[model samples]
Structure formats: C-alpha cells, structure tokens
Target: MTYALIAFALVLAVGVALLYNKLVRLRRAVENAFAQIDVQLQRRHDLIPNLVETAKAYLAHEQATFEGVARARSQAQIARSEASPTDAPSMRALAQAESGLGAALGRLMAVSEAHPTLQADAQMAALHEELASTENRIAFSRQAYNDSVTRYDVSVESVPGVFVAGPLGFKPAESLLEAPPEAAVAPRVAFA
Candidate 1:
C-alpha cells in the first residue's frame, strides 16, 4: 500500500508539472503576439509623420484633419505604452485609441485625394505607397494576434491546462481588431 501511494503521488506531481509548463507556454505566446502587434503598430505610427508631410503643402486648409490624425496618433502611443498584459482595462483603452487613430488616418487619406498636385508629387506618391504597405502589415499583425489568442484560449480551456490555468488567473486575450463602421464605410472599389 505504501509503494502504491508513492507511485500515485509521483504521477500526480509529474502531471501537474506538465500542465504548469503548458500554461507558461500559452502565456508566453500571448505575450509574443502582443509584441508582434506592437511592432507593426509602431511602424504604422512612424509612417504618419511622412504622410502628414506629404499632405502639408497641398492640404493647407485641412489643418484640422491633420491635427486630428496627429492628436489621435499621440493618444494611441500613450495607450500602447500603458497596455500591460495583466491589465485588461489598459489593453482595452489601447485598442480604443488605435481604432480612433485608424478613423482619423482614413479621413486624412480621403483629403489627400482632393489635391491633384499632392497626388502627382513624387514624395507624396512614395509616402502613399508606404502608408498602404503599413496598413497591410497592421492587418497581418491583427490576424496573427487573433490566431495566438485562439490557441491560448484553447489551451486554457483544455482539461489539465484548465485545472492549472484557473488557479493562475489565465484568461483569453481580447482581440485587437476593430470592426469597420458600415455607415462611414470607405469605398472598396476605385473607378477610373
């Protein structure tokens, strides 16, 4: 009976250790995903200055639009800095700021199209291309983040993982992607 008890205890200890390791890996994956998102977001934020410069000369009357983008971008930077993985509220705040910045940037892009000279300018053209590429990268980052969250969520919900994760306060991450407003929809198709 004593030997049997020891064997059972050993198996239980090993099982708990494996579960703990799985939880740690899932947590790290979530952290890594956030870092990936931060990288793309930072790249996108850095592109704003060039976009603003490209629009400046031709958008002299659109000062408010430019300022809106700048202000929103600043808020996003602050929010991103505040997003600690353990703080759900801060993460939500960061997501909200990012969404606002996206809307403001969209408006700036729309205003740029009104200026034929700006559209034709070589520097502005290059900036425009860069902005498009940055946007694409942001989209990819969001997808990656979502995928990571899904895996983490699955791990946390699984049998042994759940037993360990619950005690450690592990929860699924909120997705960073925001849905587009239908009423303010940007045209998907451009016509010549």
Candidate 2:
C-alpha cells in the first residue's frame, strides 16, 4: 500500500511539473510575439516622420492635417510603450491609438492627393511605399502576437491546466488584435 501511494504521488508530481513547464514556455512565446510587434511598430513610427517631412513642402497649407498626424503618432508611441500582452487595458489603448494614427495618416494622404506635384515627387512616393510596407509588417506581427496569446490563454484556461494555472500564477494573456464592433458586419457590395 505504501509503495502504491508513493508511485501515485510520483506520477502526479511529474505531471504537474510538465504542465508548469508548458505554461512557462507558452508565456515566453507570448512575450516574444509581443516583442516582434513592438519592433515592427517602432519601424512604422520611425517611418512616419520621414513621410511627414517629405510631404511637408507640398502640404504647407494643410497645417491641421499635419498636426493631427503628429498628435496621433505621439499618442500611439506612448500607448505602445505602455502596452503588454499581459495587460488588457494597455493592449486596448495601443489598438485605439494605432487606429487613430491610421485615420490621421489617411486624412493626410487624402489631402496630399490634391497636390499633383506631391503625388509626383519621387521622394514622397518612396516614403509612402516604405510606410505601406511597414504597415504590412505590423499587420503580420499583430496576427502572430494574437496567435501566441490565444495559444497561451487556451493552455492556461483548459483542463488540468485550470487546476494548476492559478496555483502556478499563470494568467491568461490578452490578444493584440481586438476587432471593432463594425468589423462584425460584412461590407455592402454594390455595382454602379
């Protein structure tokens, strides 16, 4: 009877240790994913000023648009600094800031479109292309981050993990991409 009890305890101990190790790995993966997003976001932020400067000469009269983009970019930088995959509010703030920046950039682009010279400027075109490429990288990073968070959260919340996670201080992670309410509805397609 004593040997049987010892063997049972040994198996349980090994199982829990394995579960703990898995959780640790998942948590590390989530952190690594967020770091990739941070790097891409930093690249996007760095590209913004060059883009703005290239457009400035042509957009001298569009002061409001320039200010809006600068302000949005500042807010996004702050939010990105404070954001973490472990913190939901910070992640949400980062998303909101990024959205605001995108809108501001869109407005700037629309305004710039009115200036044929700006559109034709080779420097401006190059900057815009680089910015677009950075945006694509950011999107890809966000998707990767979200996938990591999902995997971590699932492990933390499921099965025997549920019993061990809390005791081991493993908390669920927040995804970097939270779809806005508008995203739930399909877009209308019309042929005019």
TM-score of each: 0.89, 0.92
Error of 2 at 60 (Å): 0.8
Per-candidate Cα lDDT values, in order, are: 0.81, 0.86
Q: Write one digit per residue (lDDT tens) for candidate 1, span 1-192.
A: 999999999999898888878878877887898898898889889989888977887878878888999999999999999886556688788878888888888788787886788889998888878878877887787788778877887888888788878887887666665634742465242325
TM-score of 2: 0.92
| Candidate 1 minimal-lDDT segment of 10 residues | 182-191
Candidate 1: residue 39 Cα off by (Å): 0.7
Q: Which residue segments of model 1 deviate by more than 4 Å?
A: 182-184, 187-192
Superposition error at 31 for model 2 (Å): 0.7
Candidate 2 on 63-118: residue-level lDDT in tens? 78789899999999999999988888999999988887887787777777667899
Clash count for candidate 1 is 0
Inter-residue clash pairs, candidate 1: none
